[model samples]
Target: MNGSEVQFWSFVTAALLMIIGIYAIIFMDNIIKKIIGVMLIGDGVNLVLITEGFKPGGIVPIISEKLYNQSPGIFQEFADQASYSLPFALVLTNIVIGASTLAVLLGITIKLYQHYNSLSVHEIFKEEKI
Candidate 1:
């Protein structure tokens, strides 16, 4: 496939994942479904971060005097452009945070299921006093 076509598919895949997550959150009554939906949304967000980090025909941003000397103009041009590493790093951090949050939330869900003996989120909340 052509490069653009490939990129388009990549975006579409991410989008579809996000849509599925949203649907899961909206229609599913089980607490697990909500957690899965949140995870799917996180995946879609990570995909967006990856797409942003892509620089077409661009090399990794490794700065060094020797490399710069070899291609002085090229190095300057590359430096002038934005680097992908920062966004990539941020995305990685966010992924870790999302995972941690999901784990905590899932633990709470499990405890809730143990106490309630049902997977229905509405029932769990309904049993609450306020």
Candidate 2:
């Protein structure tokens, strides 16, 4: 399809992912499932950022020294047609942070399972009622 259509669909997909994640986080009763929900939300946000940065018929936001030396006009044209880099950078940073957070959450879940011998949120909360 066209550029606008592609962007529209991507945004819809991102919204759906975020909705599902929120549902899981609020309704699911397992710690691991809650962690997955958090990850899904992060992924949805990342997708939106990447989609916003996308440009149809655009090149990467990189300039080769050779291309720059070829002609100022060509360099300017390339710069004009390049996609935005900031969103990509932000997504990269987010992915790293999300992965680390997921790791820590999973580790904690494992420890909780070992202590409580169950993964249900209700079971864990009941133990903490004291």
Candidate 3:
């Protein structure tokens, strides 16, 4: 209901998203699930970065005459250093990479399916001659 409560919930939700993503990556058998797991982890991480940038009553980092009239908080420098943009950008790059990897994996999966007429990974491996 209050600010601290909201912040606490945000962190908890972020942590849960991260945990779910890890579990999906480790335990899912399908290649698609693994890719989705990676995305879920990315979501959690992005949430954490944005959350860290939160400061109660803090203004946007834009420079304006009114803003200049106000003091940048004592932690402003640190906050600026820890801004979320870079991390978000990194996640975007990773997502693109992840998608490419998934596409390659899907191609492999499709080839296996065509050759063996089955989608089960174990079946595909059993059909392998070498």
- Candidate 1 Cα outliers beyond 4 Å, as residue runs: 77-83, 128-130
The digit string of per-residue lDDT tens for model 2 on 1-130 reads 9988999999999999999999999999999889989999999999999999999888988887887787767877877899998999999999999999998999999999999999999999885755
Whole-model Cα lDDT of every candidate shown, in order: 0.83, 0.92, 0.69
Ranking by TM-score: 2, 1, 3
Query: Can you write out model 1's per-residue Cα lDDT over 85-123, one digit (the tens) per residue?
Result: 776898889989998999899899989889999989788
Clashing pairs in 1: none
Check candidate 2 and list the clashing pairs. none
Best by lDDT: 2
Off-target runs (Cα >4 Å) in candidate 3 are 65-130
Model 3 lDDT per residue over 7-52, tens place: 6787898999999999987887665676678778877876776667
Lowest-sum lDDT 10-residue window in model 2 = 67-76
lDDT computed for candidate 3: 0.69
TM-score of 3: 0.59
